[model samples]
Target: MKNSAMIEACLACFAACEMCATECIKMISADHLRCIALCRDCAEICALCIKLEQRDSEFSHDVMQLCVESCTACAAECEKFAAHHDHCRECAEVCRKCASECQAA
Candidate 1:
């Protein structure tokens, strides 16, 4: 349970990212394409990080690093649409938290 906090953060971020991506798709446009792609990638990376950490994989640290990067990028992209999208705002916040947790882990 050493990585409990990190896992929790990743779970939250994963949910947020998925929700954001779904919303983005509903409002699909050229401007939202990057946001959607980033959210999807971030969610996938968060899920992978959770699995790696749970099993205490040898590559957990490496994956966490990648997760941090992914979350950071996703958060930034989502933030751009925060003014017009609640889901993007929420996802950005969760992504930031997850990135912080991943860095700590």
Candidate 2:
């Protein structure tokens, strides 16, 4: 597993995104909508990245790149409300780490 570290990072990010989305849904509002959407998207993409990386798919590189983009966008969106939301802060942190890992991978 050459991408073992990246896979771990994606797993953590996926979990964080899920948690963040769940929290955002509970506190749904106009401002939280984008965060919620991004979290969901990020989580889905991370899952796909994990599967692709695990099997060493031919499309793993492309999917990892997409994951990087998604994680970056999701992290930025989550950071907006990080001041008041613990979940957002935590998610942002994980997303950032995942983005870096994916990019390096």
Candidate 3:
């Protein structure tokens, strides 16, 4: 796929992850603050990577590599809560997929 399209998809996934993370943060009974933090970080990084790719920046590769690492970490964290939370499971899946694409990018 084209770089623009890939970036668009990544950005969309980032938004979804961000929203999921926010909702997860509100789980007062579960208190998944740590996982929510990681998810929020992942979302920010992913969005940044998309912008870097769009600009064709010199550090695009490095940023994308960072994005992959962040997403992987977020995915792992999300997976821990996935069994009990539908949003977490969906967030994990999206993070994994986005990580793969970021690696490819």
Q: What is residue 81's positional error in candidate 2, in angstroms?
A: 0.8
> After aligning candidate 3 to the native by TM-score, how far in Å is the CA of 69 from where it should be?
0.6
Can you write out model 1's per-residue Cα lDDT over 1-105, one digit (the tens) per residue?
Answer: 758899999999999999999999999598999999999999999999999888989999999999999999999999999999999999999999999999998
Residue 24's C-alpha lDDT in candidate 3? 87
lDDT of 2 by residue, 1-105 (tens): 668889899999999999999999999598899999999999999999999888879999999999999999999999999999999999999999999999999
lDDT tens digits, residue span 34-75, model 3: 788888888888888887887878988898898888888988
Per-candidate TM-scores read 0.97, 0.97, 0.87
Q: How well does model 2 score by local distance difference test?
A: 0.95
Worst 10 residues of 3 by lDDT: 1-10
Clash counts per candidate, in order, are 0, 0, 0
lDDT of every predicted structure (CA atoms): 0.95, 0.95, 0.82
